[model samples]
Target: MSTAHAYYPSAPMPITMPQKPGYYPTPAHHGYGRVSVSPPQAESVTTSGGASYEPSATSSSYAGSASEYDSSGTNTGVDLLDYMGDRLHGAFDPVPLDRSLAKQAQTSGELNAKHRELLELQALAQRRLAGARANFADGMRAAKEVQKDLQWTQKRVDALNERAARKYPAEYKSAQNRYPAPVDY
Candidate 1:
């Protein structure tokens, strides 16, 4: 702004940032003292967006700091326009790539390859399922037939043992004494 229209006061106005919870800047760390123009009051203001804050000090009373400020109210130090235009230039330039992002990208690429392998395995399983089912069915039928024949032969051996025990007791008892049945079946 031109000198005539500039809102920049001769004395720097208290910089008021939005108040944050659990954080209050003291003069020691922030390097700026607090200013209150009038007696402290229980007052607050709400913005249009519904944020509430303590009002800025109004009117005029600087406590015992009257001698510290220039009574004449004149310009001091560098111009605001020059400081903003020149010194604040490089703050908005693009930042370099962060290392964490590179690591994340590498892990994501590896996971993608693993996911592709799993997809291929799923497809192979789908392709071979019909042939595998057919082979299993054939094997099942053969196993059942062999099991049935084995059961039939076992029943015949048991029946023969029962007949020999009843019809030829004398000889059967002698045979039993010499060699006992291998199994009850």
Candidate 2:
């Protein structure tokens, strides 16, 4: 088997794009885009007498009372000129506004939103820190208990050695000469 080291680029290569001209539809100053103000085209109809006549606007299906239109105040049935005329005749009122006050309110609202996010992150960090500290304390207590148990065991072993030396003095002295006491105990 061949041992080959694979190399990977740390960053991707930059892409080069050709510059081209782009077109966008022009937007109207008011209302929906590009309103058509042209009059409707008439369709010619031939009767049994072979005479052709164009249809009239009033003869169409929409020739009814003004109230027959939608009552939502939109006046979709009215002509564009008439609609604009009615609107200009004090049908709508302009409200006075202080732009500086509006800007200040918006900034304060954004500041409050950011402050809430900061507090949430701070609370999460505090909870994680508390958990880490508690875990560390529990580990330290466990290590201390293990050390205490080791000291108790070492004391018991020393006591057994003392008893053995007293009971058989001749053999104990020879064993002591071969292996000295451990320095830590």
Candidate 3:
């Protein structure tokens, strides 16, 4: 609400006289200052399409929700009035303030819980990854040991064949003639 004073020494201090709905005083009339326009009355506004609408929602079903919005006379001196100064147009209306706030709080709590759960899952995945890496390293070491054992056995077989060929060339030559290829162990 703008409190720009419209003073006339002959009339009143603020000129509390009601002005027309859309009418505005010139800057010169109000001493070249800003003037606040009055609010529209609690009436239906008509459009060019012959349609009209009320400012606030009003219905027979409003009775059920009215109890939720009505104040318990706890607020003492606050003047709650609409633009047209209608009591029925202002404070009596009920809103879902409390229930909406509670729902919002519940949603916030659920979101926080989900965030915590996601963090825990990520941590567990990291631990599992570390364990898998360690297991893979151990398996590679074991494979290297097995390869070393296989190489040692193949070396011993070749050494034994060389010794036999030198000690008994005639016998080895006859065996080679009989079996041209090396025998499988």
Best by TM-score: 3
**What C-alpha lDDT, on a 0 to 100 scale, does residue 102 get in candidate 2?**
85
Clash pairs, candidate 3, are: 69-94
Tens digits of per-residue lDDT for model 3, 81-108 = 2223443435555467777888999999
RMSD of each: 18.9, 28.5, 19.6
TM-score of 1: 0.37
Q: By TM-score, highest first, what's the ranking?
A: 3, 1, 2
The residue pairs found clashing in candidate 1 are none
In candidate 2, clashing pairs total: 0
lDDT sort, best first: 2, 1, 3
- Higher-scoring candidate on lDDT, 1 or 3: 1
RMSD of 2: 28.5
lDDT for every model?
Answer: 0.54, 0.55, 0.53
lDDT tens per residue, model 2, 90-135: 4645443456678889999999999999999999999999999999
> For residues 18-114, could you state the per-residue lDDT of candidate 1 as single tens digits?
3333333333422233332222332233334433333243233334245434323222222333334344444544344456678789999999999
TM-score, every prediction: 0.37, 0.36, 0.42
Clashes of 3: 1
| Segments of candidate 2 deviating more than 4 angstroms | 1-110
